[model samples]
Target: MGIEAGVAGAVLGRVGASERVVACTAAARAAGVRRGQRRRDAQRLCPELVVAERDLDAEGRAFETVAAAVAELTPRVEVVRPGVCAIPARGAARFHGGEEALRITVQDAVVEAGYDCGVGIADGLFAAELAARNGGGGLIVPEEGSAEFLARFPLSVLAGAVPDWDSLADLLVRLGVGTLGEFAALPADDVAGRFGAPGVLAHRLARGREPRDVAPRAAPPDLTVVRAFDPPAARSDEVVFAAKALADTLHEGLAAEGLTCVRLGVEVEFADGGVSERLWRHEGLLSSQAVAERVRWQLSGWRPAFTGDGTEAEEAVWGGVTALLLVPDQVVPDTGVQRALWGRDGDGARGELPERVARAADRVQAMLGHGSLTRPHLTGGRGPGERVLRVPVGDMPLETRPEGPWPGALPAPAPSVVPPEPRPVAVRAADGSPVTVSARCVPSAPPAVVVMPDGSGHRVISWTGPWPAHERWWDPESSRRLARFQVLTPQGAHLLTLEQGSWLLEASYE
Candidate 1:
């Protein structure tokens, strides 16, 4: 039952800024080596702990075999994480006769690939993860018993559910809610009022159901560029160089539009009616260097042989690659693209990095045959965020100023930080009850402690206005009545607004 047999006496740790254990053999954990502890601390805790750096590329490449194995067993396989995969239980169970049978089949397939494996089945992923961690070869919690089964577990068991879970778990335990059952018993409304969105989410999870609505993404516009290789490429280097040039040109166009491409498609069409195309995705903006690297990687993995002349590049290559196309599948605004304040000479003597970036963005716009990048600028509106307007850079010829004046708008000193999305927060009264604003713009009680969105307990040094703004009073769908307040903590002053019985951190004043 133990997974530690392979690395019985050896301990492996993933090293980052400072070595922190990500995975370690059972013997190491048993010896007190723990995750999140610094390398020095881990060594002190377990003298035999072995440290090594985590190579993400290596891990991902190795997991491809696991993906292939699972793919053969079922058409639907989703990588939950790099090392873990999830197969829809219903189809697999039906195909294998039953849930237990499906688990055995999967384990057998993975085992045949020379790896030890465990399987767990439960009502949801949360429970299933717990079931897997219990060290059973196959653990299944009947649907009817999922909630009851989870109730006995102490608050500490939810450590992996979210970041800062340990502290949050301990906080709940000290609040006299030591077990999942006790925590789940509290009303959802009360939990939300006392905590925030994360709290509400955990409450639902404890109840055995986690609702999720993943929206479908919109299609990306075509930003494809193609190059023809005449007389066919005689050498691999010739085709690879052409691919890099095409990729670089495509990316340069994107950069000009104050944008970056995340996924680029590289396609090759042979003269003999053969084609090869693959999309490459990156975690960050693909620079010219990055695009070139991808070109190299793709070339290294592909060997073009025109159907039957021969498998050798010289024989079956069929007049080499006739065409190389680079397509940007996904484009997003470059958030980090900023104007340089210093000179190009490294001392801000006199520089035009901003101009350079803008020209590149413009070239991208021309290449895409459309509008330039749109940036958000402020106009006039009741809400601080509502005032911001997204204006295409090419449209700067038009005036952006408001006609006259905003009568009820708050004076100068605009908020320094305004979150694109409001964050859930809790404002409490001096009596320890949750503070709220009424429909008539009245305080339920004097506000005291303010629980920031991060779950940190900050003491209210002093506070200001429940400035009420009622918008779209005509239509119920679009109408909203909010009372905005200014709260000051040691961190800084923040604007808190209450809408429909919920508090949100809208902006901050530095």
Candidate 2:
């Protein structure tokens, strides 16, 4: 977007879904702004940074330009992301004279189209990506030299190439495994035993091996599923709604044969006779809901490219979608799950129940809005309200509770009911006087009775606490100083807070 709009100087694009910086120009990177940093943190790093909300549609359109330029050389282009892509180079290399010649030709094409890119060739996709990023202009790794070429890089590189490797990478660093070569040297069996599947995959990549074999058995002919709209669906949601059912059917077909696809291809045919297609990667088999989300993202990114004028503004008047197709790529035999030996239905209601819940959530979210359904995640805080956060169902949990201990936090057996907002109530002493907390964190008197806002009273059977907390004292705008108490009454147990001479019912223990 910065390039298209000609807005130069420290530009960063943040994904709204995660509220994290997903892409940044070289200027921002040089200024110490990195991807995954919060928007505020990035802004702080580069005060003059120009932040832009990412538009999947624009990304889809811009990549079309890049893909078109590359497709001129080879038709088998596979996009890893909006800014990165791959192609089987052996055939293209031979056709274009050699690897070096092919690399030069691909780079020249993209540069001529007003974009800069690096071309790289290696034994596997992972090494090739590193080569493209690290190689100046372009570099071609000689056959059988991928492992040697990857040895010099740090273990941190694996975190970017593989999913869920960040924590593992950090652990490796702490254990003196600083480089890829060191990690690769570990016994494969030991790595598997310690880290399970993710570690094994990372170790394979570190050794210059692709996560899976290149020539996976082709999916059976009947695996591809298609749905055609009668009048050509005009709205994107209409297609998305259909995708959910299609994905369910596709998964069922795959399950019947005990198979799963590591990569999925979503194809959309416009009424104007233009076809938009993209490949999505999911190492852990894609769920039905996950497939529908990919379709939605593909549509969002494809809208501008589908427009006649190739502009976002003109997309509203573009042709409708006529048909949709789903093709499972990289078909492999599924390593089926082992059922629990003790109880048939183990913990968390495993099996069809979760899928049913996910489908129900999808429909509800479609009818309402994305934020209509949410799940609570625990995070670092001294109070029950501060410790819990509610986020939309499908969003990634960007924030996590720190492993460190909180000095003033409450003990175990957390509250069962945390209201959206605190409800004000009165806490009275035995003589009907209001209860208060002193400067030394001592209660004025034992809380004898709790009064509801409606004037009803519940006699306190037992009481504990004056757990005081001083939080964020440096930030006056958000600073908080409060005292909390737990009181058991005839009706139920309640978590109460006293601040500024008033008591508020914070939560209740069932």
Candidate 3:
């Protein structure tokens, strides 16, 4: 699903406690991988599976245009989450002549915005959502038909719309309350008593009545900040870097005004004059980092543009990121904000050094292209060298998670310096023969001398290990099997690895 051939992929949670699979492509599911399975189990089910971390921020950014297009149909649209929003059907329907007409209007608007979307109309939010899920040109329930529409669906449909739906559904199905219709038939008092407010609320949805208020929120103030890109951005990294500074400035302005944002908006105007925007929400206050991340994520999801409706071979030559805008869509009192936790400056007290560093890095990137300069982060891996990755600064990683515990991983008193390239070295055993390591990780003999590639030799004074490491054993072509050792000499201790038939010095301890 990622930049690879079809028929492979998986995604898992980023938090260590929840490393279970979060998503999997159809190809992976067909191979027996599924969401909720552990990393090892998913891999065991399909060794070729590609694992990634969830990118909710990016998804939010991409959904902005669709949300804005929906807004054009009616001024009041409430975003429940990325990929879904709720609009008041009554006013829009009256304005457009009817519900069916409104549906077509929405579909057209979304398509024009360059996204395919589904529009669902019914009595309430839950039923409308179900209608959307029915797919195929979007679904429109007849006036007063939400009850009938919900009736046909199984109890499992309650999962997202209703809190604690799973446990209640399981218990209900056992008692023969299998369908939404049957659940709706239950006494409201009985449901409230048995399952509490959530159950009673689910009962309301089952009956086609809105369980919660669905009125459109008031339009947010136009605290939008837009920056024009002179040459437009071709690659994502530079735009993403610039996004960080913009988000920081925008949020700082909001903070000075004593406001905390609930729903935020991001808009990008492309070099070709094409435009896109989406609204994003946060449970608590969103930080500058989060804002920048969402913008970057949104940029990655954008597709390449073409011209002349498939007749012309030319692409939009003037296309790149021409401008970026950040807006605070819904704000709250700054009461919950804890300024002290953020240190001296509200935006992480970034200080001069980081700002200077960012400017220098950006300059270098502008010269060498986006990814030429990378900032290293310690992540998951099996060995010293594998433990970190260099990612373009201010850009988001696709995986977004560190993968490891890497059992038998080299313990750290990490080397003071790791050479950019490993240098080949020769080792001799006590008996004077060239040292070697067996497949079982047994050293040919105890180390006696270390010979540099330059022909300088030093007798070994102390040493440890033959710690073995292996990864992706299923893929023969790419699998790695190596044994590492730490050997000491008068100069200093070095981390060395043995593979194939030669030894290489990988790092040096201070």
Candidate 4:
């Protein structure tokens, strides 16, 4: 999309909530940009790298073309995400000549639709995804060859296969289990014992098995939740917002039966009798948030057909959404989630709250909206104030400490108090002259006294250097130059900054 918008260079990246390179183009890969690399680091590596925030709505709308094209070859095209999808190979291949022929036909179909795609067939979805990403515009893994095909790949390939797998991959590497084959060679029981449930799942993937073990059982009750908008909803946001509660109800119903679905069906009915439907797949169980997100994408992707004369066709035009339905498919046993041993959440925060407390917070948020409750998150910056960001509860923060090194960052033992606003004060030398720092970062005099805005004075017992910093020097508009000093007053220690000849208290050490 950025390329189509005339963004310079083919080196492009999709930045995620963490402001990291969630996905990048081939040119970006060639330029040493990889997934999870911070935005700044990626720009540094490829100076012309064009980055855009990940827009699921736009991606969903764009992918509708590919999905429609693929549906011509196969009826059921399970959309894994905006860019990836899967189809049952056996039946589709037989109807389209052969597996190889089907792959070519599918790829050509999408290409003819003004999009390029890779088609790969394997025993399981995981292996098929890997095969699709293989070189040579993707390749088909031969029957029962998934294990062998995956063996040569390093454990790092499992990084994004599931949540928290990166850390597990690192641990496996340190244990001399460098490749899929090595990790697969370990006994499943031992892997479970040593690494617990997540290890078992990873081992299954390594051994070319489906990520989830299907324990076949009788189909549960219909776990469909529907919402009818009185008078119909003309705006997409109205329906999208309602999807959250609908999804929540669906999940609650499924939870009551100890069941979950691998695939979800989102069907929307328009007042004009028009219908829009899509299938979303998740190897693991989808949360309520996940379901609602897919709903948003589906709505964003929907479009009415046009007449031959470039005018909106009356039959194709949708008046408004009259009803919305969520149908759970491929239901399976809910094996439950494994809690982190250290009680840490996805963002590396020890965020596990008591069940009651968590419920209370969720209820409060539901009543007051997303931003009513928030928590502080640590981020990358030099000053204590800049290092922390407040994020809404249940929201993931976009910044992290690994973004890049802060060359002039403050030393360890951060201040205990960081004021919301700058507190201007006077730092005077013994002779009553205001203490000033030169452009060379040299202080005119060392000993000084502090005068607060309230007209209170405190004697400075000791002090640290007038460390100077030049930040964002390349950008003339946002650049800042300042000198900092840690002064120990008789009352307490304070972090003071000298910028443009004015002194402000930034933080205070307890």
Candidate 5:
């Protein structure tokens, strides 16, 4: 009756059942079995159906997987629903030989991916869907027979699978329309007057008339170069070397074509069954230096968790980076356009900012390693602590800033320093005496601090009041309160706190 149920149906189909056992057809389609269905009716239909609640997130992920599998055939794949996708065939058909071959290829891919799917090809989306539905398992509606094929289908077919089919049938019979042919013969004006626009449209469709056309898919730029490894690479350094060579090859090709690539795609395959991909882009033509920097950035950013004498790490490197492909998602003409390099002008210098930044990031990555350099990002929360955070540098937008400066809050422009490992520090009372902390301690009194390993005590210079912070007050299972203070010591400025009344150093500016 509405888009909600259609979306819910697609979500349910993707989630399916989670018990690892096959569900009976009746049980699987029971009310409440799908999203937005009533729970009581679903239980009544199949008591032993092993009903599993729908997982929208998992369903969405699975839908993407299916769409990616389809992308192997054609780059233009539109996911209409969790279980349904639409692919324009004019170009794909020509590339694969013919329409039949394209259909077969799609069918084979779906089957191989462990999905039971139906594919339909026609001049329009509606006709293609009808072809798919009528084909049962898999169907192809030929260009010439599209009109003839749709004519025999009843008006009910266009209504989709709704619950009130009997009521609709009764209404049709009351109107003296029993067959699709009879309904088609009705005048569009009369149908519109009686049942509205949807009815008139239904009449037109039954008579084999559709007024839509296939939309053309957008084509990417024309520069592309690929390199396949003879044997898989395993080490990060080896992968970097290979990527460097591949970048050179791509640069040479682009130079010869008199074009420049603004975007790059990197794909990696692992020996122990793993795959990773990354996309990179530049605002202008990628120079040789820029290309090399991109390759290094990609390699440095990847880290795999495994234990060995560095042999496994080496083997896990891009030695297995068997294939490397660079595609120009965007391109610009190399016209000899130039501006005077005088008064208030340096267009060339202004244009080189992207390349300079990229090069700088690459150098830092080479020296410090990937995941070390990062940019601040705003997290999706209103709290002071959650307002801003940091993520891998290149992975997120660079200009992302904090929501606003919070008064009486932690200092702005957080430290660029990051410790390899946390160094434990001993805290002391004003009398140079170690204080013991306990959960039952009153907030009015200060708690003791002790350094790890050796119990050395440091004197507190100045201290602020215990600002108590309580969170998750409504949830008893997660409720917690902490008393914090900015305590200055001879050694450094530190933020000391009693978390749930247990003494710990929250942070330090040394």
Candidate 6:
């Protein structure tokens, strides 16, 4: 369904090497090299192969680029993977003049982005993916031809479809069935009884009898509003402002419709050709303020470059932020009885509070950064310290914190003063004796400190022995031993140690 530019080969190409040597390398169709295949072996298989180291970041950006381009044709773009995207054609076809024109436009845009891709449009995601793989380049499966087109493919394509592939394939081969057309002709009940649920599903799929509906195009709420930037704006602050305006408009529209929004979808187009979408859901109807807050929160998490203050800078920034769309995913109708009881009072009061909270949270996140705003989540682990972890504001539930604090464990809410790269300090004894740290030293024994040339000093007011920590002992090359010590000093308290007998400051409490 997509072209994987042999990421490894692409990565290898960045380095100086013979293109011929790289091309000769035989890799899996997706650029996945076979097990035990050496670089030389790959070079031998594809003589003109250009080996370039995979740039995952760039590829990620590229995927976004392609997704945005596709979005021009249809708003509903589901990214199948980093290199593949799927769009339901029924609605897009009507919007883009026709199915044929839509297909050509999508293909041309993708190709212009320097990627070779196979585009498949079918009744469903699975069928489309399969069609793309088989059609190669640009393939369209007509609605009526879905069944026939799928029939000719081998059962091998559906081997992993359901049940276990190996067992089903072995059984089918024993019975002389190979292609999907042959498989579909068999009685469904007979195959199901023999192979179980997967066989039944596979049979149905091969016959183009989809059990589920194609991705449905939900009718957007009547209150939905969208804003497109002529030159996409890339600044987070600017985007947030735009989102605020849009949210206000949406809220007003919803009020006029006598409804309240419970869920919203935010889609943004980036200047460097990237598209990002986030879905936000609230337990109850949200006010205009709440919606704006969510938009600001979402934009703050994105890292967009800023341009200096000037007309040119404004133009440049706007060019990057191509579009912003806010759709109400869910809404609740205002019951006549409830609307009569509180009238406008309930409406005005309820909405403003959530909006205020959202704005506060957004501001806090903007100041602290994304991961810094976290909530305690419990996780599966043995110790209390290991049981609980912090997660982003809107992520999966946290595992439970371990129960009951352990004796002599590190203090709660561990000191927040630790530096990223702890500076090493020389510890000295009260008598200014240099307690020579070595592999054989005991951690319980006090060691005096000495100041390094770097001018940082901590005297070992009290000392502990150098405890040996052997890690990765099974790995001959990676094995390492570290000595830990708890040292106290008038300057500060610290956990100092020697690693492989070399003095290092592992941690410090300042």
* Every candidate's lDDT: 0.65, 0.77, 0.73, 0.78, 0.54, 0.58
Poorest stretch of ten by lDDT in candidate 5? 14-23
Error of 1 at 409 (Å): 48
**Which window of ten consecutive residues has the lowest lDDT sum in model 6?**
15-24
Q: For each candidate, C-alpha RMSD in Å? A: 19.2, 8.0, 12.2, 6.9, 18.7, 16.4
Taking all chains together, each candidate's TM-score versus the true structure is: 0.43, 0.65, 0.44, 0.69, 0.34, 0.39
Model 2 compared with the native: what TM-score? 0.65
Output the number of the TM-score-best candidate.
4
* Residue range 263-298, candidate 2, lDDT tens digits: 888888989988777776765467777677667666
Residue 494 deviation, candidate 1, in Å? 28
Weakest 10 consecutive residues of candidate 2 by summed lDDT: 342-351
Q: Against the true structure, candidate 2 has what lDDT?
A: 0.77
Reference-based TM-score, model 5: 0.34
**Per-residue lDDT of 1-510 in model 1, one digit per residue for the tens?**
223334523323322112355545545655765545555666777776556666544444345456557767885654443455666788789989999898888878887866555677887777775565455465888976777777876665554354445456667877989887788889989998986755776776677664333435565456788888788775556776776677767876776777677556667777767665555555345555555554444443344434355444532333467887887765666666433432222211223436566787688778775454665655557667877766665554254444224444555578989888999999998888999777677888878888998899788888878787777689999997788888898888888988888999999998
For candidate 4, the TM-score is 0.69
Which sections of candidate 3 miss by over 4 Å? 2-97, 102-118, 144-148, 162-211, 214-239, 242-262, 270-274, 281-290, 300-323, 331-510
lDDT of 6 at 389: 67
**In model 1, what are the clashing residue pairs, if there are any?**
253-364, 256-360, 256-361, 257-361, 342-348, 343-348
lDDT of candidate 6 over 427-486, digit per residue (tens) = 555576545555555442356664643786645577554555565579989986656566
Which has the higher lDDT value, candidate number 1 or candidate number 6? 1
List residue ranges in candidate 1 displaced over 4 A.
1-5, 8-19, 25-51, 154-157, 211-510
Worst 10 residues of 3 by lDDT: 341-350
Residue ranges of candidate 4 with Cα displaced over 4 Å: 4-18, 26-34, 37-48, 226-245, 269-275, 283-290, 305-323, 335-374, 383-385, 391-402, 408-510
Model 6 error, position 292 (Å):
19
